[model samples]
Target: MTKVQKGKLISGLSVGKKLTVMVLVMLIPFSLITVFLLYTLNRFGNSYNLVVSNVAIANQYNLEFREEYDSVLYQMVARSITKDMINEELGLTNPDDMTENVRQSFDKLVTSSTSQNARKSAESVLKLLTTLDNRCNDINNNIIKGGAYDVNMSALDNDIRVITELIQERISEYIYYEAGSMELIRSAMEAERIKLIRAIGMFFIFFFIFVLFLVIYLSSAITHEVDILVGEVKSEQINSRNLELKLLQSQINPHFLYNTLDNIVWLSEGGRKDDVTGIVTSLSRFFRTTLSGGLDYITIKQEISHIESYLQIQRFRYRDILNYEIDIPEEFLGYRIIKMTLQPVVENALYHGIKNKRGGGTIKISMHHQGGDLEIDVEDNGIGMNSEDTANLQRLADGLEKAREDNAGFGMANVGERMRLNYGPEYGLKIESEYGKGTIVKILFPKENSN
Candidate 1:
């Protein structure tokens, strides 16, 4: 019942925050693509290097292995070269040393080769080299034991020559199989590279589309919120302007101002200086509060003064039958309300309620708190309407029914409209009346502090 903080409430992210979110959203996909691309490139580079290096090492041995081992063996068997000459000519002519060199190359292959076929072929070549070493050992043993030339030559042909030829064939087989594997690996890597590139293209396209969707969604949402805020502000301003116009229109009414001026002239002709002074003073206060310096709102105290001034002028006009009492608490007087709200309702009471009765009755104004609302009731002991008429008046105030020809409740209807327009539909006029008793017009307002 104390204060109200009023405005249209909208929920969403701010523009700065929205942009930051969009940037982060966009960066996520881009970052993923960057990391994936780097990882794929590095993976492909390592695979290609491993395969190319294996092929190069295998090629180096393919031709040289057979030439070096076979030439030295043949020259030694034919007696065309001695051990010293072979050693001088070839730094590694010994069967053990020659086989060790090939085994070392096989060591590299076994350690680095990923293909099972290539590893198996390398193992086969190494076994063949071991067999050749055994053959060389047998030939050497026979020569040391003073074996015959014919037997040594036969052993070279049947054992050493055949084994060396087999070894050569095995090495060639390894190179052949390894070369084919290298081609397969290269094809696979090329295919994977193409697939990864296509995946990246698709992901980038999805990222672009998602970002565009967010931009559109956020832009439309912001525009909608702005539109609501603008519409509410414009509606509030129009309501205030309408209320001000009604107040000005009331001021120019011939029955209201012209009659009051005539009352002042009559008071002067009768030499009633006190009456003239009082009416003139009340009229001045009424007009001043009506304009209220073009402000939309006034304090409860100012509204009280305005209504009191209007009643005073009326009291002079209907001095015999018009009397009013205000019973609002002092604590509630500082609260703000729309200007000229109560005056029109009180004027309507004077014209329709009090004037219709045999003799006008006193209008009592009272204010009290009802839950979170401030309720101001203007009660009049006039010829009150039946329940049906009161219901009709309530309907008209709610704008659910058309206007009546009598125009009996037009002022109060306008008052209700102004209240609902400024505050809300739930805060407006509530009418209660009984056929034989009295009518009380309650105006509801959401409580608010002035300052």
Candidate 2:
């Protein structure tokens, strides 16, 4: 395949697969190199540790030997030094006390040795120490037999010097051997450390290149798909807005239509020809404005006229009991509003508010422009809603509660949703009512037309 096609194929893979591939590509080689590097470093570390341990053991051996040698020298020349401290110088001697210090030095090395080599070296040093201690004891015994002044002092010095040389010679041999072994181990460790530094440098270079490739590839892949999804989302929004407009128009005033036709039938049966003709004309005008060729918005003048036709038909049914009035500024009449918004609010005021009253009532539709919004209030001087009903109506209007499936509470709710959908969240219904007094439903709309 061509390079472009290959890139497309790779990008087309699901995001999970792409991420999995990226992880594997980065992880495998780095993990292998890291494991090998760790193993090599561990081996070098062990080698260095062994060298340190060996040196410590050798130093301990040397220290013990030196201490024993000094004690032996003290014992051999005990008559030449202080008589109170050593005692042999005045022909007064204690052979048992003199040997006690020498024995401890030999015992320490055997107890402390951890390795076979260290133990073997300690054994040799122990043998040399025993001989030195024995020679010193023999000289002390001779001093006790001879008087201090008649003792052969030069012969005593010569004998002690010979044994001192043998002990020094053995210590020097082992120290020299351990130092040589340490030097060899250090040389190997330094070489391995240099190799590790070079490997680390190469690893970083490879890792940096892989990281750069991943950032570029993943960002491009994500951005391309996101752009496609964003376009689809915008298209769906337009379709949804159109569908909402259709739904609002579909919720026609069924109660008004059937009731108006029933009024017309009653009028005909009574042979009231002029009354039937007037009611028929009002009904025709109401439907004509209501349909408006399926348009979602209409001028405020047409909306006002539509509601007038509705009230006229209702007036025929209730006569003296139902009364209504409209007060809108001429300047505001030219502006447009979502079709069917005002009618449902007025209908609610008619049936739910006015009809339940003891006597006849009036609904007043008022409109004005305030700041950037047009505020329309539908006020009814009828038996109004209780606090619970008022709150329920507000919730229904704000879409915080669901309407009944039978569309029982849909009248004002449909109006509220259309206002929200058309003008956005800030513009919708506000309801105020007192149980026995009246209801004033204030609807706020953006001054601009939905069209």
Candidate 3:
């Protein structure tokens, strides 16, 4: 009735539960083996104990009957002993009583014997004992009557001795039969034992094989289910990531616009008419690229243009403190990338790197094609971070940690998540920094054919 036992396919079975079912199934054979061994032993043990018991009961008066009967007869005839003397010397009871005791032993043997033939042999010996006992009584009477010595003596040799010898032989035959039957019982039991062992062994081996296959099947099924579940989760993740990136891309941040407008008003008030117009143009270009006609993906040429426009406005605003450059090959710009990919890296460099420096700092953007991947390096000579801070920030860039909007490097984290979600795990951001020196953010991407 068990699922594994019936080999039914159940998709919901988890990998961890498969071991429990297999262990339970495998125990069946071992349990059966134990029960069968006990049963066989008990059965054959009874047969063996029965044969030994029959032999023991039959052996009570075994060889002594012949010798004791002959000696009693001789003593009576020679007058060497009276009947009371016979009783004291030979430990003999009255003739009838002695016969009765022996008959009872034979009867017990017959009843205890398992074999019909042994019981019949014991019965025949019991009848022979009766005849022998009667003859012995007659000889005793003759001795009491003061008969000729030859009469009793001849009778002793001819009648009593013959019967005792015959009875001895019969009793011996019974003992021999009962004793010899053990070999047959032992042989039969041994044959059955081996046969039973082989049958059980084969059953166990086949059962074990079945259990192994069952485990393998369950493991395979669970793995298949797990793979499918993981695939579905990943699919939902990709969709969610795409939606999140689109939301981040939907419009420029209102704070940047407000700040730029505030800066523009200050420049206008200072009578810097040319600086205000140039800033206005850059701001317009930055917003134009930010929208990009609502497309999620853009050519690297467009993406670089977008980042350059944002940096230009920031450079003008920071005047003496921030300098920037873009050094990508014209030929490499045709390949596609997610929109706003480089903007976050550039913004991070400007705010976290250059803005914190004592003196003015430079932001350098360059690209290198490494094997199957295109690597974009954004280097900044600014107040860089120590190893511990850099390591924690790396987790954000690798998307190992979630990025909050209020986070210092939220833009870069979003960029990194977009890179990995759009392309693959291999395509992401790498940040290297030395405290008090500088930092470089390397963005990796597969060199796909241009859109």
Candidate 4:
């Protein structure tokens, strides 16, 4: 593949890899949350099912116990009747004695039962049997021995009915209590099931939203940075082209240099030492500054001094027609700026704005602080540009050709390229002008102290 195509492919691959890694990072927590939610939901479902089954089993046990209790009551009544018949056959007459005898016999019957529940049932039966036995004995004794009906057998019958009714009522109460307990358990289980469902739904909704947001954020952040990198690469390619042009331009025209130096030498030989000395000194200084390459950054103070030196040479060449002023804040002298940044803009002001005028105009340079940025303005009250010229200026500022055949100034394009290379596109030169009025070129930079 061609080198350009290879560069594009590599850039795409790198960005894709970063996106994949970021997606994985975002998904990890979401995956864990999903697993935890599912596990918790499974546990809750199992617990709900278990509780429901337990309640059903408890209900069945309650029914069985109620039936058993009723059977025990029936057996108790039957045993009481049998005991009364036996006591009557034996002719037991005294109430106290008969009671004692029946109580002892009933205790024995209770002991004979096979199960503990049966034995407990027998105790209640025995109490009833003893009452009936005593009543029968009293009736027999009253009839045979000619005493009044002393024991009140009807009252004993009523007492037996009351006891039976009490047992039935107790059974009914137990049934009611058991039914209420089952209902409570069912209600609790239903509430818990609803709560668990709601909790699981909310967890899924929130987790989904969080994961979605994270994915979007990661995608946006990675894509924006990649775009910036791509732009920087494109800018670097353009700068490479410009560097090639500059290198080619550095080669000297020997004939022109020889002629200029010969004139200065002849003037010195003719006893014009002061003029020759000044010209030679300016030439030396200019050549020295131009050849001092490989340095990219310098203080604003140094840049201003370099501009002043260049302006001094220009003034000697053009006489007093050109006047310039540089107004900079004292505190900003220490701030670092790109080398040759201001020199190019200043050159543009002098060449395009004041060079062709009948009488040259003033060039004003001012620097100040505004909020978190430094503002530098190069204003020239010379032959200003019209609307079309302003449009061309804007195109040139964006590193595009506008009226390139005219070759308005070399420095405008150079300064714009340097600004974009150093601080990105947001900060650069902004030019404002009106026909025959004036031109103002502003350079915006981030405040060094703020940085």
Q: Candidate 1 vs candidate 3: which has greater lDDT?
A: 3
Predicted candidate 1 versus true structure: per-residue lDDT over 279-328, tens digit per residue: 99999998898888755579999999999999999999998888899999
Model 4 poorest ten-residue lDDT run: 242-251
The global Cα lDDT (0 to 1) of model 4 is: 0.54
Residues 1-451, candidate 3: write the lDDT tens digits: 7878556553455666665666776767656755765676577567767766666555656645567667767877777344655778766555556667789888888888766666766887887788777777777777667777766776675456656655655565566556556556656665765675466546546655766555445445534654453354344334322321122342256778888999899999999999899889988887777777645578888888888878878876797999888899987878887788887787888888898998969999999887887888999999899999898899987856655557786777667765664567788899999978889999888887334
Model 2 TM: 0.45
Question: lDDT scores for all predictions?
Answer: 0.69, 0.64, 0.71, 0.54
- Candidate 2 lDDT (Cα, 0 to 1): 0.64
lDDT of 4 by residue, 1-451 (tens): 9999967865776766856655576567646654654564455445434433332332333234324323332332333323334346444233334345435644653444323433443464455445445544444444445443222233233333333333332222222322233333334444644564454446446544545566445445634653453354344334322321111112233543475577577767888888777767766755555444433455677667766766765665456579988899888788866666666677677778787676888888888886778878989887888998897887877666422323564457656755664566777789999877778998887775223
Output the number of the lDDT-best candidate. 3
Give each model a TM-score: 0.44, 0.45, 0.45, 0.40
Clashes of 1: 0
Residue-level lDDT of model 2, residues 140-247, one tens digit each, is: 556656636324243243334444444444444434443344444445555665574565556556666555465445435534553453344344333322321111
Worst window of 10 by summed lDDT in candidate 2:
239-248
What stretches of model 1 exceed 4 Å from their correct place?
1-252, 404-406, 449-451
Q: Which residue segments of model 4 deviate by more than 4 Å?
A: 1-272, 291-293, 400-406, 449-451
Quote the RMSD, in angstroms, for model 3.
48.0
Give the root-mean-square deviation of each candidate in angstroms.
Answer: 50.2, 45.2, 48.0, 50.8
Using lDDT as the yardstick, the better of models 2 and 4 is 2
